[model samples]
Target: MERTILMADGQSFYASIEKAAHPECRGKPVAVGDPTRRSGIILAACPVAKERGVTTAERVGEALAKCPDLVVIRPRMQTYISVSLLITEIFESFTDQVEPYSIDEQFLDVTGSLALFGSAERIARLIQTRVQLSTGVCARVGIGPNKILAKMATDNFAKREPGGISELSRANIEEKLWPLPVHRMFMVAGRMTAHFARMGLHTIGDIARLELGEFKRRMRARMGRQSDIQAEYYWQTANGIDPSPVVSGMRSQIKIINHGRALKWQTYRTFADIEPLMLELLIEVCRRARRYGYMGRVVAVAAAETDGQRSSGFGRQMTLPRPTYLEHELSSVVRSLFLTHWKGLPLTHLHITLTDLSRDECYQLDLFEDRSRLIRREKTVDAIKERFGATAVIRASSLAPTAQAFERAVQIGGHFA
Candidate 1:
């Protein structure tokens, strides 16, 4: 056995979060998504739904075709995000080598922190228990000698046990992995699997047995140098030679709302989901506006279809009535900007951007508006909320969706939908 890393997969991830957050939707077939007329992408499906072949990225319409009684639920992106953050905080308590893989997935290079926590299984159990206790959600953990193997191992055995902490070792790899289909080796999703199958290379062990030159020559010779390099890297992964340690202090990147809805050959069915997603994006844009001490010269909303084609609308160079840094005021303008240009296409992704940047000045503030008082008051509110967290501060306008969305913003790197 080699020193191991741990991978935490959300165990049905989106669906699990939805079920955990909303108990009433637990038992039945629940699918979380935003079914806009333009793009009704399925984000997650619960365990029951999984049995019915309802999974993420299946369109609301296609899913219905498969299971007529399927229950589709609008996502609480904000809430999910908040839970994600809480999970992150909890993870930090255990190890510094935590790499956030996605909103709901993370990799813990617990090599150094092993002594403080004890064995890998102890830490895995600790993380699993704490997650269940803290968020009322259960996670499936995979422990192995490298990130890839750990992730794959978790996926292999996590859900079978009570609190999924599946371990993969040389013995298990030989017994369980070498025999499985090559497509089962992750990162081999989509077309990669098809290409391999056509060549009669059916198992990971089969692919591993071939010479690099023969492998490349036989496979239509399109495996790029990077792919070739990855092939070698994967052997290290299979043998568990990964030594990459986590590094921190990277600048926190800009926020993004990347929603992908499955489609009937890439088309949207409605517009409801995009509305909230756009609203969420606007919130981030405004928050950034305030942080940078200036209102942007442009407000833009762009939509990308499932195929990666995109279209966007540009707002007028509207100056803020009061050059302000308040989410309440700034988001109001952002909301207006988004709505005006929203034509509602089948968009898989909606992005709101603020550019043509400039600093704040007196001319931007409203003379009759008591601007200073409002901003000051809002600032106080922000400070209070920052201290006590989002649930403490709720504006009347944001009362409906803001609670879950805001909680997720500070706590989870959730896109506020």
Candidate 2:
């Protein structure tokens, strides 16, 4: 049976949400970021800002230079997540095979639903209308025989065309997809684009036309043993063929959990100033890890120093003696990394990442430490916090002047409640 995949992408997601919430900013050039921080960059820009040459990730100062009247707003991540969940619920109403590509994009395998929905294009139109009416945000929908074409159709044509819907199939591959530059092709990064250029493969058509033997030979020189796999995948994608399934219920595939924060105030000058903040972040990270029933062996700490002009940061990773989800173990490593790597710089941000994960159910006892007692203690603390509130149970250090636990507990993604 031919697969029918649809990609639905929220247009200028963050900025659109802001505009929808604040109707007065509909046609104005608005950018979202930390308005209080002069060095903060534009996280998202509205269509009007885009028209004025303001782009996301550019510094607020630069965006202001491009459009003097641009309005900068702080990000409200919780609001965005809520809206995204609502959108996903809408997708779920159409098909059980909905896969979230990101917070703002999702792919739905509606092949089975085609019998009930009538046609792919009809379903796309219905979804687009439903999203706009229900969420007050417009969405672009792309329909194709497979995932790759569906995504490309949405990105390359649907987003730009009127009515915000586009369809790509084998019939239209030559006319609509071939002439596009190699860089525009999915998964083709700058370095790979240069490799394609070196091989005189300028467009997707060039790749599609290459003989299998010749493609593998060239790819082998660049990608080693993985050349055969990469060559075939690239060639198939160039011809608009994707056999990958639209996986559903994908929460089990997550391998890492990370939490980071940029300080609202630059009070961190030494280890003493930053230790409490690090401890708070570590507790949060471990709490999340335990909640997910996962434990990590590798823990990484990153710190950024704020100068007058730009911020510079360094990161270091260390493997734990055992895979455990205790806050004390992770905090010890974090403190040690901070002490050894930090040169008493003015700190502005801190990040903690947990990787090399395994299921917590499989955790073995460590001979050196009372692992069971520590786990029970932390789990009790988690229960207390969960039952009352995040700030209900707190450490004495968190009450110190340098700590931000009390302040952050009320926040959703670094913004004030």
Candidate 3:
């Protein structure tokens, strides 16, 4: 009958990730940061570091003063980003209701479905367990009647227990909420705290003592009342009320069905290096065309020329003697097209686009040329790549001097020497 929001917070997420990947750091105090001589500030601290008095965003010097033996590690963005995506996939497996609150925090609505798994407490514990199993990191979860309460409940549990779960409901609001610090009121961050202090309202109980409207009138007029919205949020949380939904109603973006490569090299050394690149670009264009059941009839290239002049490569509509997903056949067309168009010009950036697509690929055979046989052979090449891999099929034209010129270029950063 009541809705619940489950908040999953990876305890000291970044630091935990490093420690998880390397078991050698287990149980030792560790801080995630860029440990430079000048000042390596803390980004996140592990549970061990927290136990030793290190906290996030603290100066390296201050953190060291607080915890002398803190082991600070430089973060690898790539690894952390992958971990974030992996966690997101796990959340999606449970419910699309998963909404990421931050890199390590998420809210899931389990109101209607908590019973399918177990109680809200059970669900939270299960999520924490799975995160550990998959990521080698522990998580803390708060299960509450609303998002506000759920988040606070989770934070409350995390500070006191590791890999812990707690549930907050209207039934337990007063007994659980009242004794907490007056300053523990929800949504009362720095600005609201300063304003409340200025108005001599020192605690949640102090604000609760006044008329809601009067409380606003004394603080900062409209702004003070606005803070009440946040106050009301936490007040309701303390009362076991949450107005937020776990299920976020948002649409997923369509994956790129038609992929294209837009390339920019530092500089083009010769016509040799630029030509193979054209075939490389076209191969991608044709692959997307095949996936989407289309064939592009026009292929064109654009380049930045020497002397700061911009030159558009010659473009022509091409109909394969047969429709192909074959690298060799497409390579032949690309080579012929490049030779006809390029006149030994040095270039910087090159953009190749294949356009004028036909979704209906079946064409009537001309009496002058029977292209059907070529199409079937090309299709076989496509199958090899589909089964083996992208790099599985390379045309003989790939041997064209164009492919090797860049490798031989004496230029630094690919610029002409």
Candidate 4:
């Protein structure tokens, strides 16, 4: 059977959610970000702000200079996640084969649902209307025979039009997809684009017209051993011949969980000022690791200095004598790593990563530590936090004025609310 996949992406997601929560901001120039921080960047901008030349990741001051009347609001990441969950639920009503691409984008395999819901275009329109009416956020829907084409149709066509729906099929590949620049095609990196340009291949049609062997030869010389695979994939994509399936419940395969925070201001000038914050991050990371019933053998710590260019940072990784999910064990190693590597540089960001993962039950007992007791205590703490709230139990160090744990516990994705 011919597949029918749809990609649905929320338009100006963060700004839209802010507007939805505050109806007064509608039709006004608005952006979502931390306006209080000097280095704050625009996370998302409404259509009005976009029309005034305000763009995402642009500095707040610059964005204000572009549109003096712009309304700046802090991001409420929890609210956006709630709305995304609602949108995902709506997609699930249409098809079980729904794969979330991000916080504001998802892919749905509606080939099976077509028999009950009508044609692909009809389902696309229904989903768009449903999302708008239910969430007060508009969604652009793109329909295609496969995931790549659906995403491309969304990015290149649907997002630019009033109807907010577009379709790409094998029959219209030449007329609709070929005229676009090669750089616009999915998975075409800057180096690949430059290589293609050097070969006088500027459009999707140019690449599609090359013989498989000749294309593979050129790609090998340009990209190395994986060139044959990359060349074939790109050639097929150019011809609208994707065969990948839309997958759901894929998060089970995650091997690492990390948490990083870029400080609101460059306030840490010494390790004394930085230690508490790093401890808080370690606690959160360990809490998550225990919650997921996974233990990691490797701990990686990274720090980025305060320079606006972020040219200086240190990253170091160490393997534990035994895998652990306890914060105490991980924090000891982290503290050692930071103190040894730090050069008294004013830091803007800190991150902790846990990797070399295995199931929690796979760990071997340490010869010196009371491993079982520590594991039990950690699990008990996790249970309390899960049942009550993140701040129900806090480390005494977190109570220090410089620490951010109390503030972070109530926020989502390191943003307000």
Error of 3 at 99 (Å): 0.7
Candidate 2 least-lDDT 10 residues: 408-417
Candidate 4 lDDT over residue span 17-67, tens digit each: 888888988789999989887479999999989999999999999999889
Write candidate 1's Cα lDDT for 1-417 as tens digits.
455688887766667777776787757887887655315888888778888888778788888778777777778878888888788778878876777788777888788788888889999888988988888767788988777778788766775767578887766776767677876776777687777777777877777667766675655455645566766654555444566655531225333322222233143325444445455456555555555455554554555544345544343334554344545554566567655655555555555556555444343556667767776675666577568765475544344442235645555545543
- Candidate 4 differs from the real structure by a C-alpha RMSD in angstroms, to one decimal, of 14.1
User: In model 3, where do residues sit more than 4 Å from their true spots?
Assistant: 65-68, 198-200, 205-211, 220-242, 247-417
Lowest lDDT 10-residue stretch of candidate 3: 251-260
Selected candidate, larger lDDT, 3 vs 4: 4
Clashing pairs in 4: none
Q: How well does candidate 3 match the true structure in TM-score terms?
A: 0.59
Candidate 4 at residue 149, lDDT?
91
Model 4 misplaced stretches (Cα beyond 4 Å): 251-417
In model 3, the clashing pairs are: 146-242, 182-204, 272-402
Candidate 1 segments exceeding 4 Å error: 35-39, 65-69, 159-163, 198-200, 211-227, 234-239, 248-417
Q: What is the TM-score of each predicted model, taking all chains together?
A: 0.55, 0.61, 0.59, 0.61
Tell me the TM-score of model 2.
Answer: 0.61
lDDT of each: 0.65, 0.87, 0.65, 0.87
lDDT assessment of candidate 4:
0.87
